[model samples]
Target: MTTDRTNWAGSFSYDARRVHAPRSEDELREIVAASTRVRALGSRHSFSQVANTDGDLVSLADLPRTVSVDAAGSTVTVAAGMRYGEVCRELHEHGFAMHNLGSLPHISMAGAVATATHGSGDGNASLASAVSALEMVTADGELVTVDRDADAERFGGMVVALGALGIVVRMTLDVVPTFEVRQDVYEGLALDTFEKNADEIFAGAYSVSLFTDFVAPTMTAWLKSRVDDVDPAGPDPDWMGARRAASAHHPVPGMSAESCTGQLGVPGPWYDRLPHFRLDFTPSNGAELQSEYLVPRAAAADALRALHGIGEHIAPVLQICELRTVAADEQWLSPAYRQDVVAFHFTWVRDAAAVMPVLKLMEQQLAPYYARPHWGKLFTHEPGHLRSLFPRLSDFRALRHELDPRGTFGNAFVDQHIG
Candidate 1:
C-alpha cells in the first residue's frame, strides 16, 4: 500500500496505480490517453486530496522550461511545472518580479495559479491574478489558450480549477518592475493591536505576515516592508530561527521542530524571497493536522478575538495560528475571489478524536462571518457548506462542464466540491 499511495499532511494518504513523467504536451497526451484516470501533481505541497489518483499519476517534471519575459508587455510565459523559486529568478534576471510569493519556493507556477494560491499582501491580489493568458489541455486533449476578454468566464473559473477541468500546461503572468522588501518580528502584543493598525500595517509595505500561537495571552507579529519605501529593524538573531525551525520538542512554539513552514521573508535575491518559509520539517515529534479559514477582512479583529477568547481550550492542542492577507481577485474558486480576505491557519497536535470537537466548535464560531475554507488545506466545510462560500460556484461548475463534459480530469475531490 505504501507503494500504491502518496502521503499528505502525515495523516492522510491516497493511491495511484502507476506514475508517469511526461516531457512535453505530446507525451502528456499519450499518457492521458492510456490511463483510466489521471491527476497532475506539482511539488506535492498541498495537504488536500485534489491531486490523488488511482489510475495514473502524471508529473510535468520533464516539461521544457517555458519562462519568457516580454518587457514591452510586462508579462512572462511559464511552463506548467516551473517552480516558484525558478520563476522569480528567471523574472528577476529580466528585471521584473512577482508582487508576492507564498512561503514555499518549490511550488509550481501552474499548480499555484491553478489553485489561486497566493502570497500575503493587503493590496496584493493572489498570484493567479498575474495571468494575462495561458494554456490548458482539456479532458479530450484539446489545447486551449484563454485570457481576459477572451473566454473570460472560463479563464476566471479555471484560475482555481482544482484539476477538475483539465491539466494546466502553460501560463502567462503579469509582472511589475522589481522591488525589495525588509523583514522584522515583534513579540507580546494583544491581538487587538493588529486590528487598529490593520490598514496602516498592510499598507506600509507591498506584503506582510503575522504569526502567533493562540496559547498565550499575547501574540507576536512579523512585519515585512517594501525595501524602497520603508526601513525595517535589523533581524534579531533570537527570532531568526525561532519561528521557522522545527520544534525539537512536541508542539511547542518556537521549538526546534522540522521546517513546518516552507520559507519566508525577502532573503538576499529575488529568487531567495520566493519561498513562503525557510524552515524544513524536523523529524516528526508527533502527528499533526491542519485547518484554515478565510474571513471577511473587516471582521479579522473579531475573528482573532473569538479565537483568543477561547484560547485556553484551543491552545493546549494548538501549534500556531498563521495570519495572512490578500486582495480580492476575479477567480471564481479563489477564497478571496471577489472579497478581500483574512486567512487563519491552525496546526493542531494530531489527535483526531479529541480535535474534531474543537474543529466543529470553531466552525460554528466562524459561521456568521461566512468564512471560506482553503481548497488545499484541511477543513470541515463539506460540499453543501462549501457551496455557500463561493459566490461563483455555479459559474465555475458550468465552465467545467463546457471544457470537460466527460469528466476526464475529475476525481472525488471535484465531485464533492462542484457537484
Candidate 2:
C-alpha cells in the first residue's frame, strides 16, 4: 500500500491493503476470482467511504478506454472508468450529448451512476436515469448484463445499487444531438424574491443553480440556457429584481472565477456550459466537505425558510450552499425516487468536529420534509432512519443478496445501512 493512496478529497483514508490496476477485463476477472474481498474504485471523488473496502480495491483506470457511439440507436457505450468530461467531449465531437451533467464533469460514469449523482433542471432526471444498459462482473467473477429497456424490477434496483450488485465495467447511456449553451449570472437577488419565484427561476433556463453563503446579504444565480431552447440572445439587465453580472462570477463569493466555466452569456458546447466549474480546475482543491439533502419539490419554499432560520449557525462553516432541482426517477435507491425534489447542497469547511453538529441541526430542521440525503456525501442521518426513508430499500437488499450471495462485495457501509 502507498501512503499517497487517499481519496481525492484526502479526508478519507481507505483501508484496502492493495489497489489493483488491471489492463483487461479478463485480468480483472482473474483478480476478482482470486481475491476473497474486493470493491471497484473509480475517480475517487466520493466524500464518504461508501466505495472503500478492507481487503482489496480495483481501479479500472488502466482498463482499455472505450467510447463507442451507435449513432443509429442514439446511445453511447463507454468504458465505465472514463470520466464524464472525457466521455462527454468525445460524444460532442461525434455530434451527440448526454441530456445533463453534474455540477462537475470529472466524475466517472460508474461512480456517478451508482450514487445517482445529478445536475440541475426541473425536467432533468438523475444521471443514472440515462443509463439504458449495464455490464458488470458478478461476485463469481463472471460477466452479467442488465437492460433497462427490456425492463425488469431488477434493473431499477441495480442502476443505483451502491456497488453491491456487481462491479460495473461498461455502460450504455442515452444521448441526444449536440447543442450549445450560454450561462448567465444574476447578482443581488433578494431572498424573498427567490422564495416567491422559485419555480419560475428554475424554469428560466435549461439548468439553474442558486448560490449563497446562507448569511450573505444577497445571493447569486447561475442560469445555463440551451441555445436552441432559449433565445440565443441575452436576458434583460435585471431578472425578477436581480441585476445582470457585467463580468464573470464564481459560485463561492470572492473566489477566483477563473476556476469556473464561462459566464456573461457566452455560448459554448453543451459539455462546457452545463457544469459549474471547468474540468481543468479541481473544485475546491479537495479542501471542502459536502452534504446534500433532496426534499419533495412542493416543500421548496418551506425548506428554504427552514434553513434561513439557521443561517447564523450555518454561516460560520459554510463555504457555499447551492439549491438545484431534479425530476423524479425510478431508480430504487435514488433520493428522488418517485418524487421530484429540490436538493440543498452544502460545501463545508473541512472541520468535522465543527461541521457534524451543524449537520445534525440541519437534519433536525429538515426532518419534517423527511429529506433524503445524498448516498455518497457526508451525512449525519442515522443509518436505520436513513435507509427507512427509501421505500424500496428492502427490495434493494434482496437484489444485493441475489447478485452477491456470498457477500463478496459487502463492505461495512453496505452491511450497516443497506441491510
Error of 1 at 27 (Å): 1.3
lDDT per residue for candidate 1 within 1-419, as digits (tens), equals 11324443556656777777787789887777666577887766566677876667777877888788899999888897888777787788889988778866667777777777877878888888888787877665667877876876467887788877767788888898986655545455555656676666555445666667875555555556565665354444344223322212222455642443312343354444333354233233226777788898998888877876667777778877777888999899898988999888877787767666887778888888888887776666667667788889888888878777777777788778887
lDDT of each: 0.71, 0.88
lDDT of 1 at 386: 78
Off by over 4 Å in 1: 1-4, 231-252, 256-267, 274-276, 279-288
For this target, which candidate reaches the highest lDDT against the unseen true structure? 2
Candidate 2 residue spans exceeding 4 A from truth: 1-4, 282-284
lDDT for each residue of candidate 2 in 1-419, tens digit (9 for 90 to 100): 12347787788788998889888999989888888789988888888778999988988888989999999999999999889998988899999999999988888889999999999999999999999999999877899888986757578898897788878999999999999999999999888888888889888788989998888667788999888877545777799889999999887788888978888899999889998879888665478889999999989989989988888899999999999999999999999999999999999998989998999999999999989999889888666776668999888888888778888888988888887
Model 1: how far residue 287 lies from native, Å: 5.9
| Counted clashes in each candidate structure | 27, 0
| Top TM-score hit | 2
